[model samples]
Target: MKSYDDKHIKNIVLVGAPKSGKTTLSETMLFEAGIISKRGTIEEKNTVSDYHEIELERGNSVYATLLHTEWKDYKINIIDTPGLEDFIGEVIAAIRVADTAVVLLNAQYGVEVSTEILWEYIDRYRKPTILAVNQLDTELASFTKAVEDARRAFGNNVTLMQYPVNQGPGFNAIIDLLKMTMYRFPKDGGKPEKLPIPEEEREKAEQLHNELVEKAAENDDTLMELYFEKGSLDEDELREGIQKGMLQHQVFPVFCLSARNNMGSGRLMGFIDNVAPAAIDVPAEHTADGKEVAIDPAGPTGIFVFKTLVEPHIGRLSFFKVIAGEVKAGMELTNFANNTTERISQLFIADGKNRNTADRLRAGDIGCTLKLKNTRTNDTLGDKHFPGPIAALEFPSPKVRVAVEPQNKGDDEKLSEVLAEIHLEDPTLLVEFNRELKQVILHGQGELHLLVTKWRLENIYKMPVVFLPARIPYRETIQKPAQASYRHKKQSGGAGQFGEVYLAIEPWYDGMPPYKDHPVRDSEEITLSWGGKLVFNNCIVGGAIDSRFLPAILKGVMEKMQEGPLTGSYVRDIRVSVYDGKMHPVDSNEISFKIAGMMAFRDAFHQAAPQLLEPVYDLEATAPDTMMGDIMSELQSHRSIITGMDAANGNQVIKARIPQAEIDKLFAALRNVTQGKAKIKAEFADYAPVPADLQKKLSENYKETVAV
Candidate 1:
């Protein structure tokens, strides 16, 4: 394969719902551009984009695939991303560096849940987008309906640039309404033949052509006048206006094609060459210093690492987008986030598993770097004096949880080091150490995401790890006030020890929930002053306890709080006052006061209304109204309460609150009931008191387990 420089770069991300032929389109484009000898098919399991073993076995894309091909003197970097929600992170990473997104829609299905989600992301980024309605030759294909669906989902800005001439079994050609030309292709891949519009389709083509001209004219005053006066517009003027409209997001042009037959692939390429934004045409990106930098082939080098892949044979491969100047092999660039310099080597443009080396990369291009020590996904690389990080795409938090442990006894040390590196590669994969639970928990978007991490552990790091259901982190608190006192005495040593401490525990009734506001912070000490008038006055004029032992008594109270009275869980929010204490002048020391404080806390907590606080999760679920009954019933089974329900895109969104432990397997349940059509997002909410019966059972269960 021949390599190209960045001057002719165009980065485009292919996105859509599952079974939308995104991979087929990539294969057709590669074959037509002479980048490949024969097109690979998804059914044959030889497609370049879905080349991963897991993908081939599943017959669906599980990650994003990078492919580079040359067409019309332009080097196009195409990213094929997974359509399933489980792998939406891959789609997010692709859009981070892309200048444009082409959303593919299955002709029969129109626009589905995944397509709408991808479009939302594109809108969030304000990136230029095009809609490609695929499977035009299928028996259920309907170009008019597909266009209408796009308009309904994305508003009236959706405009058609081309239309298929015929339906299934008779599909043979596509007509460019704007260019007023028809491109016909044979079954096999080859150059398309430009011909006059078919006689039968001429009337429809003219109507579409008139609509296109009017839209283009609306964007250009001169074209509007010319169009009004002459009833038509010149080709150049129409093209320029459409290009401007596309750049400004005023119009989203839709195209139709059969990717398997390679039909309309060349015309699609022609549109990309004419309508897609060049490096210099893209809006200037702002740096961290608030300085605007132009995206030009000759500008200073600024590379944004959008994605990182850990291959068993290749080590770490980072895919980066050239946002500013140029990058060459062996050059050094500073990481803006960490302020560390890294040497670049062996730059290559990848097409799935295959790669072609490039001498240098310029603005608006995507390429790969091998073996960087500190550079990671989302890290920006540029000159040290003006280093800047690219704005990261907003990714949803990992909602699923699993606990992982190294299989080998000694592998624990290596497991942590390897997982840390893995987390660096994909920030979406979170590895957290639950100090209270004493578990290494791994969280990701879904079950497959966690499974892929385990696969990486075994294949890349040569470490076997066992995964188990993660335990929910729970807390203990009190509901009423109680006071207790205890004394400690010992005379075995030369210096006898004697000390006594008094403490009081009370229920926390502050308006705001404690841990919900500060999810991860440790328990903090809160001091209350009651006018500082010896709040714990003994009223004993004859000093019963030595004043010097006061500090030791207070220290003991702190130790008791740390070792919770009920379940060893950290106690929080209750107030403790070391009011009155008696200490022996000769025997009293720190140890004696500490023991006294421990006993006092244990006695006081039982007097207080101690209870277990279980965590709740805020859930938002979207499902069709017909399926709402099923979903609500399912939620009820999980001990969930619906707070609100609303309408969205022909679906009912159920906003509910449920316990975290109750919905541990919600993903599987949701998929089963909705047939993988439901969408759900959840976050940690406030904690509520567990019922008396359940609390008693939990406490006893915990004690039994501890004893074991």
Candidate 2:
């Protein structure tokens, strides 16, 4: 609701694995900052960040929500993001706008999949990072073990900024290594009271303090010398070194807290203020057009739209990060991607579902603009000549796909239109129409991702929908060579037509000149060349076939190629040589030759060795060593073979090749097999011939379906 200049703002994003207390930590930070009168538990569905109906029902954030709270005269823009693997796009979007990432780890569980994922994302952006070991009051909470886990997960970059003085029910205070003081929680349930460090924990605290000093010294040679000489450093010197170290990604400060109980929130806020980088601290960003620009208040205005939200009643909302100069209401900026100018009708800062109009936005600030034509997420806005576009945020490929249909017949138009709008808001979700299958396919990261999208379509768009399993794209091709002929004769017509065609169909093979010579790159599907060297010698020694009919015959053969001789799917890699044919002087028309050619190809292909080519995918799975055998066996059951395997961070990275059909609804199977410990990624590899046994049955089925 209020705008803060770059100097007075602290952009911190809360990220981690699902159920890692990111939302809870946000609520605690808001309450402790006195932004809210009372804290709302996630179970009650009253938390500020997870306010959406779906989020409340699921008890996990499905999208990123921005909340602002003023603490100690600084504006802290806290971005609460989804921790589930399905909604990684939301986490990436939030990370792009934040200056620092506060990764929350469940003290009991330590690191999980989502936590490891966020670590890589934060590392990619190279932003200052802080580790918040949350839920310290839980039954299995252990600060020491959690600290060790963090170090193990993130390598030696992780350093403790503060350690829990006690654990579980005994968790009453936190030792602030920077200030060398302990903040003791009130036993009667009130604000924590500051006190001198206890004598018993003093020795351990000092040890941690020395460790902090050693890590901080690496940030600057002067600081390192200061520490070596005095065996310690002053608070101001240590704070400066910590900030420098964090911005350079040299030392990651780890802080402990119990977000659900609101313990250590105030200290968390203090650490963010002192440790997080300001707009000036981060390096200047480059526009998509390759121009380096600072967050200059005086330069030409430019903003990168990182997120888009669609409201049922309200218009489209575009969330943008200002990269250069400033933007104000009524100012128009060019959308370089589309090469169109969009007027900044009104600018607002997003606060959950509500947005407050702002007169203008300076660099390094996130704001929303209403109803910008031709503007979408990842598009940059700037002056007409300098329409800067920011690099698009990378998102994981969709792992699950399903065909969807409106439950009610009349909701089709509305469902299609509304889903299009919904997809504009969240780019991670995909909607596509499969003309061949006659289905509207929706793709997402996992099953839950699609489920949430479907739920939103029903509730937000007021449309009921049904989902069906995705069908594998199976193809048909011939295996052996065969010859056949067809004659077309129409005597009833005034211009009595007559044509004949003879063609041979053969198996498409590799290492052969025309077929095998096609560029074989590291991608799915080999490139096919037109008229390479199939040798279609029209050896009609006499005037039996007209020269003009050759094009018609080729066209007919091309059309038939699309609908293979076996399955009704597209055919690939075969050579059909039309060596001979007959034609009448007056009846050798294009239509006659077309029909004759089509029939001739059909006859020849049936005799040829026909086969089915199924789509295969390169599968990569990473899991603990204990589950390596299970993962490998699961792949084997899916008719897969391991290509390679290697050790990665005490886990096994298994690489295999599998059929796409076997991986449909793979998320469910993976969860069942690995107990949710294994994760996988797959990409289309190549279309290979089906196994001998399966090919026989499929070819038989294809013949029956296309019987004349």
Candidate 3:
């Protein structure tokens, strides 16, 4: 292993939809670079990138894998990412640290749902990208149609650099527009022989070549002027122009390849090594506080941990990118997130499952360190004198939730520890312990996401678990005002308990209540643990009830609020006035007054009209115009109120408010209805009253559970 300067390092990530041949492409690239003797197929489960047991069983990539190869004096680091939407965290992390993204498109299907979804992230990061049309040897492959689809989805910036000559089962040659030559591979598919363009195809090739030159010239003012004077650019000038155009996002070159047969990959690798921008060529990153952090090989050392993996027998493996200066073994750096110092014990460059020991990793290069004490994913480790920490990756919020419980009685503690370890590996898997609902909730992307998590827990951690539907946190509130009085009397042998409470309960709103007639002794506003407010006012006249007893009564009232009278849900938004009460000197203790206050509140709550309030979420669903009617109908069936509708990026944006109860498994249902073309985002809006029939059914169910 050799240490490469920043100019000689090229970091790139492969991204696309599932079954789009990303894994095969990476294997082909590795084989062509002589890193591997033979190409491994996904069906055989021997591909370098898909090495995990779960991935082998599923015949797809479940995690991101790092592989590097030396091509033409450049160390090209390739990050192969998962294409399934459930495992999108892997793709995002890879894109955050890579300099360029190579998005593969299946020629048969063209731009797909997953392709559109990944394009959003690529656009967000403003990455320089190259579109590779893969599976060109398949029966249904069509290069022309694929180009048309890319133009429609991505706009006019898509420029063609290569096109298939005879693209079917016998696909062997591709016309390279940049060099105005034909690369013809043999039937067995090894190195391609460069030849002049045939006479029949010369006219079309020349036209496309001129178009490429024009597109390249548009990227720089000097290039444009030189093109106007000379009417064309030389080969060297064209390569420089294309590189500038790619960095500015003015051109997205499209290349054709058949990854399964290992054809056209060498040309793509050559283009990447010669044209793609290096890590130091891209713009500088910024901190969360808007301070620029340059990628300087001479500056203070800084490393950003983008991914963490937990091996079977080994400890944690932290994958990081050197942002500034160099990292070597036995170097100490400050963890900016926790303000803790950690020592780098060993440095290695990853090649799928294999690792090569390296003496040092320079700036703008990716490598891994073993067993850092406190550093985790998204943490920044740098010199203590650095100004601030680097910006963290913004992950998508969880869309689906399920309540998980241990199969055995005493496995709760073990489950907690295992869940913490899982979170450390993948931060998107959220585990929340809801004390009010008495359940441990696991939130993830979708059903498959949670299913994979459950598999890991049972197989890796040896913990059997059951997943159930999560309970909705419904609330209870009063509708009107009512008055009640209760007297608690106990005649024990030694001491007796005697306390009476008279309280007025009313629905509280924004402004202060009217206590004009009575002089208020104590008044305080409290925020309920559930969702609303509780207003307590003490208007006792002439010490009817002692001032010290007021807090005890409030405490009892709060206890009742935790378990509402109707359905045992948390209660909120009510005002209680201890206007008058009676007490005994010896027996008027906290317990007596507490019981008295509890009884009186229950009596008054029954007198007033009680309502059940359920949580509502603001939902935004983006889908094509053809699916708008069906989506709106589906939302209406779930008791959703359509708030607004607008157009966004050629899709219809539907905004609505839907109840939390109705959103269970909604993501899976939407995927089925829209053919995986729709994306939904939801957040907590507010609490609204549940329908009368639903409220009655919920109350009856609660009572039955309590009785059992």
Best-first order by lDDT = 3, 2, 1
Q: How do the predictions measure up, each by TM-score?
A: 0.91, 0.93, 0.95
Against the unseen true structure, what C-alpha lDDT does each candidate score? 0.79, 0.80, 0.90
Query: What are the per-residue Cα lDDT tens digits for candidate 1 across 29-91?
Result: 989888898899999999889988778878999889999778988888899999888788889
- Tell me how candidate 1 scores on lDDT: 0.79
Model 3 local distance difference test score: 0.90
Ranking by TM-score: 3, 2, 1
Q: Which candidate has the top score in lDDT?
A: 3
Work out candidate 1's RMSD over C-alphas.
4.9
lDDT tens readout by residue for model 3, 1-708: 977999999999999988889999999999999999999999999999999888998898989999998888899999999988888888999998999999999999788767888888988888888999998998999999888878877888899999999898889999999988899998878799999999999999999999999999999999999999999999888998988988887789999999988889999999999999999988887887888888789888999999999888878999999999999989999999999999999998999889999989999999998999898999999987666788998888888899999999799999999999998888889999999988999988777889999989998888999999999999999999898999999997988998899998888888855655456677889987577899888988887788888888999899999999878899999998888899998888988888899899989998989899999999999988999988988899889999999986567899999999888656777878987778788999999999999999999998898899
Clashing pairs in 3: none
Task: Give candidate 2 misplaced runs (Cα > 4 Å).
Answer: 1-3, 188-190, 384-387, 408-415, 513-543, 692-708
Each prediction's Cα RMSD? 4.9, 4.0, 2.2
